[model samples]
Target: MSNIKKIVDIGDKELEVWKSGKGRTIIILPGMMSSLAEWELLYEELSKEARVIIYYRAGYGKSDKGKIPRNCTENAKDLYALMKKLRITSPIIIGHSYGGLILQEFVMKYPNEASEIILVDSTSYGAHKLDEVEIEEEDGSSTEAWVEKCKIYSSLSKEVLQVEMAEWITEMKKNLSSSQHLEVEEFMSNPVMFESLSEELEHDLLTCGETNQHKSFPNTSTIVIGRDPKASITEMVESEGLHRSEAEEIELIWQTLILNQTKLNYKTTYIMAEGSGHSVHLEKPEVIKKAVDSILNSTEVED
Candidate 1:
């Protein structure tokens, strides 16, 4: 019931693809550090009613890692090229996390390509600004004082702390949109690439956060935000300098940003997945599916 193949000339690398169904076209984009495998459930469900195309991004899954740019805009351009290569027109896009951000870029950058967007736990900022974070050292001195900082880079990133609560760990892992994999493993192994990617991602993500005002979609869109527990929220508020009101404010700003830029008289829906984190798809796929289906049904094409 499923067909799998590889396309070698899409982006800077090959895209491993799984395609099914035969009706309206839908492209499923998974989160960073995740591949098409993460969309198995949603793919299966959507395939029953629509043609679904699922593929891994460059540097993910069976996709090759070439010398292309790694920023979200580049990723979105690659996606557009792939779809054009495959001759798909006006597809419905299901994007999660970084994939969601890529979809946003695609919709804004190529307004004619997609009919709608489903944003799953996307990050947004009213302004493209980054917080200045302090790096702590074990010696209680500034990171500048550490002479061999590069030596400990690999150790710090790869080190996974042992969890005392199995249930909580299981739940946490379930809710993650992405996780470490072979490519991530390789990046973590190479200190230079690791640090380089981190710094690049820092600037890229800040740009994405700030450029939210310029991004828009032409059709219908929906956003799902996974709510962490009150305890977790409290901790984030205290440690990250974000109050509960700030979170609410950010959500409101995010909605307004997308709604204003949308060109197709866009209808927007917002869903809050309670007791979950950013990884609502993995932690609560059913909830996401229900929300997605609701949007698709509401915007069903007339006969």
Candidate 2:
């Protein structure tokens, strides 16, 4: 089926949005340093059964670069504006990685906007606090390992940045075409993408803390997706210089954080998407569809 793509103006920022399928509204938000291209396959698959919407946030893809000091609060404000501009309401929202953090802020700020929530191996609400506290990797590495990596990415030249990024999301983008790959490449090529990514990460602690400060989230139907540790443990040890034990510790924290989110929701379901790392939606599209179908079916039954 044909997917409609164009620029959408949400006040000062103009976002690039894609629309496909023709059933209930399904809104998918990508992670930090990510774009619509990375999850095209999943979008297409989901489009076959439901209306699908994915967009490039400011500074990514064709979207305009928003002001600096960008954090979850600002991002949530933008998302609300975009939803209003699109006249969307009660959409089933799915977030992956940083997108999940954004989802938390959004539901907290605008409780009636979304009918359902799905987090695909998403960032924990308070994981950013690790940047403040001590998190020793195997060799007693600095707690800023991940933050340092983002700083490096922001400093690299465009060509180097693209290559560095291409090395990642490789398995998840296996279905991506050369053209689609170009879209991803173009996204990485933008200096603003790196800048925006770094800023968001820098403000992550604030975002998490602010989300915590907000009153408890409204009673919403939510789903939390976690990854099978095997998919990422080896990478953490080999690529990230983490000891196996350290990696296991981090994984334990992540799993615990995910499970705890369910307690915050009035109705919730937690599922582990296997055979993939953090980008579970890309590696296991069927599982995402399964989640959507289950929720849709339950809603139908409730009605």
lDDT of 1 by residue, 1-303 (tens): 765565647745666677898888888877654545446666777788788888866655455545754666777787998897889987878787667777777787887778767777664433232122332322332223222343344235333312222333343345324542333333333433333334325445545455444754555454544444443355445644565765445444444544433333436665666665556666577777776566568667543
Worst 10 residues of 2 by lDDT: 134-143
lDDT over C-alpha atoms for residue 110 of model 2: 92
Where does candidate 1 have its weakest 10-residue lDDT segment? 129-138
- In model 2, the clashing pairs are none
Question: 189-250 in candidate 2: lDDT tens per residue?
Answer: 67677767767776775455554555788888898888888877776778777778777777
The parts of candidate 2 lying over 4 Å away from their true place are: 129-175, 210-212, 238-241
Assess candidate 1 and give its lDDT.
0.58
Q: Would you list the C-alpha lDDT of every candidate in the order shown?
A: 0.58, 0.78
Question: Where does candidate 1 clash, by residue pair?
Answer: 127-210, 128-210
